[model samples]
Target: MAHIASLSQLQTPPWASVDGQLVPYDGVRIHISAEALTRALSVFEGVKGYWDPASETFSLRTPREHYERLLRSAKLFHIPVDFDYPEFLRRLEQLAAELLVRERDLWFRPTLYVTEGHWGEGTRATLVITAFTQQKESGEPMRLGVSTWRRGTDVDLPTRVKSSANYVVARLARIEARRLGYDDAILLNREGRVAEATGACVVALLDDEVVVPPSSEGALDSLTVRILERICHRDGLRLVRRPIDRTELLAAQEVAIAGTISELTLVSEIDGFTFPVDGVLARLRASYLQVMRGTEHLEGVEMVATDAGRALVTS
Candidate 1:
């Protein structure tokens, strides 16, 4: 396992990419009156990169998928991306090289925001790509609780689009959970069906089957969950998608949360109900790590080291 440090412990890198240009991290800035700040007209993606010691390379898992999601989010928010997919990817790879990222696992936040002075629609869009060393927390299971706050429906805000404004609801629940000494909170839909955690998709093992809530139930269409589904199919593990209830989660044999940053985190307790770390969860977690590090290959998922990343690793 990579040594994970806390965000506070890791120092910020010297460089970041802004509008396709590499600049000093501190040099990158947005005006205080930017529309994205005032109206929260921003969409972003959190992508993970793993450092493989065996190959001396850094593998970025599914960059194209992340980029495609960002584009979808931009379309939903009316934020125009000036560059095409290939051009944007090339710039990101350049930024990663400029940052000199090598041996450590990394987290990249690629944000598209409205930068025009006006707060309403038809504003100029700006892209900022920032990469940071990933800090892995303890491998211990997380303690979660069901939040009183309900997730927004499609009519309220399209949950599938990862808009910055949409996260405020989850943030409130997270604050309440931390105040109560829980690791995080699982939110329910308006109809009292299990939605998801603040930033992750929830999964549970029930009767020897892996089950998750469908995206229609106010959950984000999670890439991590899709990857898990493929792993289950390959491994002969049963995977089911359906509406889950709070009581069902409480009665589950095991529960876990999957996300780009969180990866596969086991939920040790929920609403005082506890579960053991079983072998199935362990196998899935191990398989995920393998897939991420390029040791295990899956179709439709690419884990490649960028030229810039390779240069840094070699240097």
Candidate 2:
């Protein structure tokens, strides 16, 4: 979408929840000198709300887990969450109620921006919930390539925290991937171990075991990966996390990228190595599709479905 300088702001919903207060989207503002703008001091979470045709409701994937992770990011960056957790959730409930009236898919991102505080004065932050209508991907097969850009280590902008700054790596990696004639890039660590795909977690099926790189390898603490692990255990598949060398990914039986936005896209060809469409990723996608269609529900994650108004369908 082309972001027109002034008019682009008008395209989103009329209202936004800023620091627990629902305000006009046009009225939402942050100074040019703000820490989020100047120092890139902001952390956020991506939550997808899928519109289910059968139930005539919106199904969200792990909004609670996303929020909890956001809070942890805030804590790590010294950005105090200025809003109450329950109230924060209620704000989402309140926002979803009003916004989902159109009954289409949407993406809600709750970003915690460090509005103030440097030195010993104590940092403060603002929670802004922005909702926009987005089309859900049908999980396509992707051509993956390894990028020369290594994902940053824990000491240098850790990958574990879902921070705004992390997008630079993803953004650059994506551009480089496309430029290199591929759909996306797999970022390797300094040690040449597989970290993750550009913006999603990496899952490889090696010798019938679903293998994932550990967080120590600079992979994000992915909720989608957690769901995949549960699915593997439920289906009698072994899932393990360890450092994956660059060559190991080429040898994986099936490889895919997992995330909220990316969904679960299988990697068809990586570095010229082709993985014929197989049941490994297909099985995972089946469960994910079930979750989307609400045949299978998330445990502890509220699937917010709007009837005439807002209502919570908890797991």
Candidate 3:
């Protein structure tokens, strides 16, 4: 996923847990020719943790889903890591407690990076858990734009996996959008259908339902979008999964970007086409925040606190 901390004044801790070792951030290093750097032999998951002052805890949103997706990405790219799911969670809890202070939201980037070798040979993956605090406002809904470049298909780059190399395409598109004075870019698939916006999913409201482009159309399986899907089903909101045309989005009543970092940023316009700030997106955003930020109790969230006496002691 694209960095959600991009819009925030993020604070990084002094230390990072590198392959189960707590190493200082400045001490962390990899060779310039490492496979991860040269060939992008890595996959990562961005886990957001909401800090609840009343409870004195950091509630992690859908960690299991994100973990499964991370494993799938590693499997797809053959990025072998030494740690299993149990060990992974242990490291995350240990790291977050060490890095994050009380009363602050946390973000973790658990990345499996190959530090040596090349072209599917002589490679070993290391788990690097990078932590940050969402210390600033994310600002207003992004002023979005559409890139002229077409996104790669599953047959080539495989959007089903959140591989590091896949983002090179997004980086290019993002540069183009920034130059044109737009905050972010939405890339179309090879067939001119809406795939996703950079690292976020493209969600549009039409009539009574919200439309999301399927993974078959080059959209990555998004964790945030999946949560929103369940919210819609539970709340009786109609959410459709299909290919979305650019014009279809333009003509829709509302548009927004959904992902781990962007959360539910409502779109102001796209390629000069304006979208209204409607109730549908607002409701979805509100429900999502209520669930994610611990205001509303929901199933499948992992809460961790610095001290056992602080709050809901899920860890």
Cα lDDT tens digits for candidate 2, 199-266 = 78998989889899999999999988888887777778898998889998998899888887666778
List clashing residue pairs in candidate 3. none
Candidate 1's C-alpha lDDT?
Answer: 0.82
lDDT of 1 by residue, 1-315 (tens): 122123424667788888988888878888878888888889999888787778777667888898999999988877778888787777667776766455677778899878984645557888988887764343667898899999988889888899888899998888888888888899999999999999889999999999999878988989998899999999999989999988998999999988887788888899899988766887798788778878898776777677765687567
Model 1 ranges with Cα > 4 A deviation: 1-11, 117-121, 135-138
* TM-score of candidate 3 versus the correct structure, residues matched by position: 0.91
lDDT ranking of the models: 1, 3, 2
lDDT of 3 by residue, 1-315 (tens): 134335224454788889988998778887888888888788998888777767666666677787899989988898776777778877777777676666567778888888876788877888888887774244367778889978898889999889888899998888899899888899999899999988799999998698899999889998888888888888899988999888888888899999887788888889898877657898898888888777776555554444422433444
The per-model lDDT (C-alpha) reads: 0.82, 0.78, 0.80
Judge candidate 2 at residue 49 and give its lDDT.
78
Query: Can you give the TM-score per candidate against the true fold?
Result: 0.93, 0.89, 0.91
